[model samples]
Target: MRLTRGGKQNAKGAGQEMGGPDKEKLVPPAEGTAVPNGEETAVPKAAEPGPVTEEDRTRSEEGKSAGEGGQEETALAQEDGQRRPDESSLRSQLEAVQAELKSALDQAKEFEERAASLQAERDEWAEKAKIAYEQFLRARSDLDGFRKRTERDLEDRINRGKADLILALLEVLDNFDRALEAAQKTGSAQAEGVQGAYASADSSASGQALQSFIRGVQMIRRQFFETLAREGVEEIPSPVGKPMDPSLHDAVAAQEGGGEHGTVVAELRKGYLYKGMVLRPTRVKVIR
Candidate 1:
């Protein structure tokens, strides 16, 4: 092989260093001469690679392709690594959102339960109020009835007091009537009895005086009866021939008379009725 001038000089210098022949004395070998084995001079030379072959070229191309493939694979791996972090962050966000949604749902359920409880309490109070109101109404009605009854009782008591006074007066009037009847039976001849201060009531002092006193008593009795009648007090009928009623008549005595049995034989005493009710029953004798 042809060498450059600088390369030849370097080879000669390396041969001198190993104590070999100089570069100028080195000649070409004789034709067909047998080169000695161990006596040949050594020449130091730089190591060189061998000539490139077709197979080596093919191997170089394949290696270049493989290197490019490795670079692409590394790039793809880096991209995947970058995307993994973002995906992880998104997953964490999704989990947080789901947890928040579940917590919110739970709180809502609790609020619903509380609302229902409050509603139940309100309904219970409403029921109690209704009961109290009904009781109050009933009490008010009872009070009203009691008040009316008390008013009626007070009125009845006042009327009974008036009736008692009238009844007392009627007893006095009854005594007066009996006195008048006895005086009439005495023939009005005793003028000394009724003509006390007024000795000359009329011209004839014997008959006129007592007769005038009797007329005055009769007028007083008539006035008393008219006043009693005006006040809704009336005497009960006690006819002798009528049937005796136990409700209106008190049978003081029973007698065997000619009339029908259980019939009124005689009216012993009169009765007074203030209203439709029996104030006093008529005293009568019934025929047995």
Candidate 2:
């Protein structure tokens, strides 16, 4: 087998290699020199005067970045210092606004409390007024009822008292009627004897005395009736052959008489009227 040689310098264990020539070493041509084949060679960069390590390059770049950051921070601090008074004024204004808001809230709460208290008081007074009004209504109703009842009772009492007095007077009138009837019957019988005796010559003392007694009884009966009339007492007419009035007449007996049916045949007892009202009914006989 044949082995090919790659370079003129013999490399030792792939660590070092010899460059091709001065052209490969990157040497710049002179400024006025013409380039070979119309192609210009690349200009070589100037070599660092001191050999800089990787760590030193990194350190320098970091220092340059730090300086630029510091300058920016200083400018920001200067601007913040210039605006410090304005920031403080804004803070004070905010605090004042908060205080005003708190004061307004407190006033509103106080107003609400006052309104609630007034509402409660109004409710209480309204309830009292309602109760009083109800009581007044009840009292008025009771007064009306009482007045009506009292009037009714007074009328009834007056009527009863009148009735009692009239009844007592009726007893007296009845007795007088009975006495007058007896005296009239006696005088009539004696009158015939007196007339016969007086026609012949003179009347007897007993006959004259009896006639005088009858006249006196008649006058007393007439006087009693006149007094009753003055006291608003009147007779309810219950004549025979007259129409029977159930309101003023009570039928004591039904008989066939000289009158139409349902007519007053005879009045047995008298009836009285007082103030246009029937005080007593007439007891009468009715025709059947």
Candidate 3:
């Protein structure tokens, strides 16, 4: 058999020319230029220069960021400088406002305290005035009571004096009546004639003459009796043939021709009372 040159061969018998190209010796293309069919070529570009390695790219980015950061920091510093004085002015104004508010609160507290003190003083004065007024009213009431008591005492004294005078006058009248009765019983001609003459005269003329003669005495007696009557003086019940009451009557002696043991034959003297109080008891003759 005839063997060709391109025939499959064993690894041990293969020549050095049969191996693949060396990858380690291969070259890359130059900047901005395309490689030819099988050869690498280099070309320059007009754009900005690119980083040659990883470390060069990182350093270029850091420089660009640092420049931008420096410009921003300058602007922020200017803005802060502009606002600092205004902030200080605002803080000063706030402090002044707080001081004014504190002063106003203090003044208000002082006014409230003064008002409370005034109100307390007014209440105290009102209480004192009320007490004084009550005292004045009590004094007036006491004065009125004293005046009434004094008036009552004076009236009682006057009444007692008038009652006593009236009693004396009544006794005198009783005696005169007895004298007249005795004269009537004696009845002598001369005495009868004199009595008749006295009776026949005009009663008005004789009464006027008698009243004139005893003017002073009668006037005193009449006034005394009127005063006693005004003071509630009164005569006790007395009539002919009435039964005698031991409580109101003074028995002088036993009488004849009476109906029973308690019979009142005659009244010797009248009884009197002042305001339900017995002034004098009736003197009488009672049948046994």
Candidate 4:
């Protein structure tokens, strides 16, 4: 029995060694473990993320610059729109000034045309007045010439009438001279002696009266001849010895005579000249 008991103990000891739990093993804690009251709660752990690359940083900066540029362009467009109306108004004012200048030039040209026409009319009137004055001067000269000619003709006619009146008075004086010459020739023939005695004895008482009368008549004839000679009445020369001048003599008869050709033979009636002009030609006989 002792041996058998020892074998069992040994067996049990081996089993015990094989079947015992390990003393080094961990145990789970209780659900409400106590912590310090003032301490903060536990933070969640951050998840692991990707690293920053060069291309991602560049894209972010470009987007920020483009937004700022868009704002500046919109402001400049508004300012250009405001200035457009002012430029249009200034162009309209310049066009109006040019139209006014053209109107003034047209008015000045019209005034010049009117002035030229008035000057031409004045020159024409002045020329006409000068021609009229020249015509009046010519007419005055012609009238003066006619007046002088008329005065000269009137003076010539008056002188001719006075010459004709003087010629008629000269003819009456020539006839009175012939009567006195004939009475002187008869008285001289009676004065011869025989005829003188017969003429004195034939008178009776009346004869004595006639003899006294005859003597008285001889004295009257001598006185009349002497009075005429003193007063520029003289006989033309009719000599028997000289040649006959036709200007002073009228031949009553022709005869063969003692003198030369065309000589005076005898005087029939005496001729007289007054102031070297013939009053009457002498009547005479001439030798042919």
Candidate 5:
């Protein structure tokens, strides 16, 4: 096999050592002659340089790879020494970021809890307002009812008072009627029994006085009836000569008379109505 210059030198040095022969004492044997015992063979001259073989190319690649590997190892060691402080700085930055994140999380949790508490308070206030509104509605309804009832009661009391007062006044009216009838009868009888012109004149003067009194009484009755009319009190129609109605008249007595059966003959006492209600029933005599 062919070798490079360095490989050839190493091989020559090894051959010299193994041959144990000095180059000066070595002799070339003649052609076709046998060598003597213990004599070494002649060393041939080295061949000339030749084209590179596959083995030579492979060995050169191995040497270049070894040199590149050593350079890479040295660069890696330098990088490790330079990166120590940078790695420590990065670690500090990471720790600060983690602390900030933890603080933010805690604040968010506190805010969430506060928001929940506020919502609960709002709901409580809303419920209170709703209850108050319902109570107000109930109170308003009750007040309206009470007002209406009070008005009704006051109206009833007023009507009842008016009826009682008017009934008392009716008795006085009856007395006035009786007094006028008696006075008229007395005047007529006295006139019928008069004997002389002088007595007739005296009777006429007395009649004038009686007529004045009767006109005064009539004026008073007319005023009283006007006042009662203003207070919603009205006299019922006379039932005399008509069929007696139970609603308007009470039969005080029954008599045989020149009238239809169950017909009212006379009204003993006048009846009155107050505000469309019967205040008093007429007392009448009915024909049997």
Candidate 6:
């Protein structure tokens, strides 16, 4: 090892003082040997560390900070990598739940629409049923009224027929009463004549009374015929001297006569026609 500049100068001075021949050249101390100052030395002081500068100290501090920052960044990156798949799975599950909720809402709306349609149909059918019931009630009422009217009309017709029959019989009773009055007058005149006992006068008065009775009978007959005509009854024409008609004449006897055969000789009973139909045929004698 080489000695320091200061150590070399000291050795040169010592050598000169010792009266050595090589005074200009100085020998270095051996490694780890004792120097003349009683201090052990291994190498020259020139090989020792130099004084630290501000720039160097600053650079060392910056390097240590950069290393610590790099380690922290690496740890954060590893933690992020480990959590990525869990975040993706959570997002997917949330989307699926949203889709299911949307579908359920759609189904509920459809069901509400169907229920509204069914309610409308039910109301329409109820209206139709109400109309049908009203129609049935009206029809029943009309039928009942018709039946009542028919019965009333039938009863009225029967009552009118009975009235007509009674009227006809009353006409006959009136005529009979008139006939009885005339007969009573004739009997009273005959009794007076018989009580007086005058033969000639009695005969004349009796003839006059008989003629009056005959006139009354003829008047009654004419009045009866008028009543029958008013009731739509008419006498058939006399069949005497006419050909016998089986529809109008009923032959009661036959006689040999100067007239043609099958001819009516005399009418025994009067025939009547009511409304152009035969009510009674005439009883007649026909010529054989």
Model 3 — TM-score against the truth?
Answer: 0.51
| Runs of candidate 5 exceeding 4 Å displacement | 1-53, 63-116, 147-151, 154-159, 187-199, 256-261
Model 6: per-residue Cα lDDT over 1-288, one tens digit each? 333444455555555556543422334766776587874444423222334445545655666677788888888888877778788898899899999999998998998999999999999999999999999999999989999999989966864674467456555745665666677777667666666546577577786777677678767777866876786677789988889999999999999877899999887766777657676678899999
Model 6 alpha-carbon miss at residue 84, Å: 46
Deviating ranges (above 4 Å) for candidate 4: 1-232
lDDT of 2 by residue, 1-288 (tens): 111132111222122323322232345678889888967578645322233345555556666677888998999899999899899999999999999999999999999999999999999999999999999999999999999999989977887788779878887887887887887787777667667434443446666787788788788878987987887789887567888888889999998766689888778888899868888889899888
Candidate 3 weakest ten by summed lDDT: 3-12
Error of 2 at 120 (Å): 3.7
Candidate 6 wrongly placed segments (more than 4 Å): 1-199
Error of 1 at 266 (Å): 3.3
Residue-level lDDT tens digits of model 5 in 1-288: 535565555555556666643254445877887877957677655533344556566776776787798889899878887898799999999999999999999999999999999999999999999999999999999999999999999999998988898899988888888888888888678767764665767677887888888788888888878888898888899988999999989999999968799999888888889998899998999999
What do the candidate models score in CA lDDT, each in turn? 0.78, 0.76, 0.68, 0.59, 0.83, 0.73
Model 1, span 1-288: residue lDDT tens: 434344455555555666665343434455676678735444444433234445555666677788899999999999999999999999999999999999999999999999999999999999999999999999999999999999999979977987888778778878877978876876444544555675655435557556777888889888988988887888998668999888889999997768789999888778878866666778898889
Quote the positional error of residue 89 for candidate 1 in Å: 5.7
TM values, all candidates: 0.52, 0.51, 0.51, 0.31, 0.61, 0.36
Task: Indicate whether candidate 2 or candidate 4 has the larger lDDT.
Answer: 2
Which one wins by TM-score: 3 or 6? 3
Residue 137, candidate 5: how far off, in angstroms? 3.3
Residue 217, candidate 3: how far off, in angstroms?
14
What's the candidate order when arranged by decreasing lDDT? 5, 1, 2, 6, 3, 4
lDDT top scorer: 5
lDDT of model number 1: 0.78
Residue 283 lDDT, candidate 6, scale 0-100: 83
